[model samples]
Target: MRRSIFETEHEQLRDTAHDFFLKYAVPHRAEWEAQGHVGREIWRQAAEHGLLGLEIPEEYGGAGIHDYRFNAVVIEEAARTRSGVALTLQNEIVAPYLIGLGTEEQKQRWLPGMATGELLGAIAMSEPGAGSDLAGIRTSARRDGDGWVVNGSKTFISGGLLADVVIVVARTDPEAGHKGFSLLLVEDGMAGFERGKKLDKVGQRTSDTMELFFSDVRVPAGNLLGEQGRGFYSLMRNLPQERLGIAVAGLASAEHAYAVTAEYARTREAFGQPIASFQVNRHALSEMHTKLQVARTYLDQCILGVSSGELTAEDAAGAKWWITELEWEVVDRCMQMFGGYGYINEYEISQIWRDARIQRLYGGTTEIMKDLVGRKLGF
Candidate 1:
C-alpha cells in the first residue's frame, strides 16, 4: 500500500538521510559492531546534517522542526541500512524531555551541545529491581542545603557510557509513593558518578548499553527537571512518543526484512528454478507482504496522530506491541526462507532476526503493552 502521510519535504529529507547513512554508517558497520559502539564522529556528522535536534529550537542551533515525520524518515533510512546505532534514543526519546521541560538556563546550558552532538545525553530510570514499574524504584535523593545528594544505581542504560549528562530518576520523598519521585541531571566528572562496563547483548551490538552508579553525588538544585514531585507524570507523558518511535522502527525493519527476503527468493534456486516460483515460498512472501502493508498503514496513522497530539498512551501501547511482535514474526519467517544460510552470521537476515527480538522486549514489553491497553479499556 502507498503511504500518503509524508509530504514532498519529508521525501526529500528521506533521500538526504538515506545518502548520509549509506556514505557514513554502512562501511563502518563491522567496526562499530566490533567496538560495541558507533564512533562519536557519526554523532557529530548527524548533528551537522540536522538529524540530531529536530525538537530543539533554532536559537539553540537545532533545526527547530517539531514534526515526527522527519524523525520517521531518519529511522526508516537507518533501518534500511541496518545500522544498530541509537540515534532515535537521542533525538526521539531524550530530546523531548529537554525541549519540553528544560528551563531557559537549562536549555542554554545543554541544548546547544546536544544539538551539536558535543554532549551526549542518557536517561537513568530502570534499575536492577525495577524495569517498567517506576513506583518500585529505590534510588533516593535527599535535600542538602543548596544541593541534593543522590545515591542509586541504574542498569540497562542505553548510551550510558557516552552520556555527558544523565537525567536520573530518583525518589525525593520516600514515603510519598509516586509523588516523591524527581528527575535530577547528573553531569560527568561529578564526584562518585561512575559508568559500568558495556553489556554484551544478543543484538544491536553497535549501540552501547551499560550500568550507571551514583554514590552520594551532589547535584545542584538547579538540575531538577520539571516539578520536584512530578517526575512520574513527566515520564508517563513522554512514554507515548518513545513507544511510537519503537513502533516506527519495528515497521521499517519488517519492511526491510521482507524486501531482502523477496529478492533473495527471486534469485536463489531450488530444483533448477527460482525458489520464489515454488508455491510454498511464494505463499510465504505473499503473507509477509500483506503483513508489511497492514503494519505500515497502521504505523503511518499512529505517526499522524502522534504528530498532531491526538495519540494516547493506550493507543501507543497497542502500536508498540502489535507492530514489534509483527516485526519479529516477519523477520523470523524471512530468516527461515534463507534455509541454512540464515543461521550463518554473514547473512543479513541473521542480523535482522537477532535485532528484531529486542523490539518486543524494550520500550515496554508486549505483555505490558497489552496490560496497559486492557486497563484503559476499563478491565
Candidate 2:
C-alpha cells in the first residue's frame, strides 16, 4: 500500500536511520545480546548522527521536530535491522514527560543531555505489587523539610540499568486515591538508590531490563515532575504516543519477518521445487501479504491522526492491541514456514518470534487494551 503519511523529510530520515542501524547496530547485535545490553557509546554515536532527539527543541540540543512519523521511521529501521537498543524507551516514552511538564530549570538541567544521549532516562511505574493498576503501587514518597524521601522498588524497568535519571511514580498521599500519585526524578548516585542485576529475559536481552530499589532516597523538591499528585494523569496523557510507538515496532517486526520468510521459501527447495510453489505455503504468504497491507493502511491513518491530535485513547489502545497481536500471529506463521530452522537461534526468524511475544505483553497487555476500549464503549 502507498503510505501518504510520510513526506520527503520522513523518507530522508528513514534513509539516515537505516544507514546508522546497519553500520552501528547490526554488527554489535551479538555482542550486545551476550552482554545483556548495547554499548553506551552507541547513544553518543546516535547523538552525533543527529538521530537521538528529533522531538526535542533545538534550543535544548535537539531537532525540535514533534512529529511522530520521525519516531516511526527510527523504529522501522531498528526492526528491519533486528537491533534492540531501547532507543524508543528514551525518545518515545521518557522524553514526552520531560518535555510536556518539566519546569524551566528542570528542562535546562535535563533536556540537553537527554538530546545528546549524555543522560539516559527511564520511567519507573510498575512495582512488584502493581503492573497496570496505578492505585496499587506501594512505592511511597514522604515529604521531608525540603525534599521527598522515597521508599520502594520497581520491576520490569526497560532502561533501568543505565538510567542517569529515573522519573519514578510514587504514591504521595495514601488517602487521596488517584490524586495521590506523583512523579519524582531520582538521579543516579543518590544514597540508598540501588539497581538489581540485568534480568534474563526470553527476548529483547539487548534492551537492558533491570530492577530498581529506592530506600529513603531523598529527592529535592526541585525534582518533582508536573503537578504533585497528578502523575497518573500525566501518564495517561502520554499513552497515545507510547502505544503508537509500540504499534510501529510490532508492524515493522511482522513485515520484516514475512519478508525474510517469503524470500527463504522462494529459494529453499522441496521435492526439487521451491517451497513457495506449494499451495499451502503460497496461500499462507498471500494471506500474510494482504493482512499486512491492510494493517499498513490503517497504521498510516493512525500516524496522521496522532500527529494532528485526533487520535483518542481508545483508538491508540485498539491499534496497540490489534497490531501487536497480528505481529505475533504473522511471525509465528513465518516461523512455521522455516520448520526446524525457525527454532534454532542462528536464524533471524527465531529471534523475531521470540521478540514478538513481548509485543502483546508490554505497553499494557492486549487484555488491558481491550478493556480500556471496551469501557469507553460503555460495555
| Each prediction's TM-score versus the true structure | 0.99, 0.99
List of clashing residue pairs for candidate 1: none
Task: Tell me how many residue pairs clash in candidate 1.
Answer: 0
Candidate 1, which segments miss by more than 4 Å at Cα?
none
lDDT tens digits, residue span 192-262, model 2: 89998788999988888889999999999999999998999999999778998899999999999999999
Alpha carbon deviation, residue 202, candidate 1 (Å): 0.4
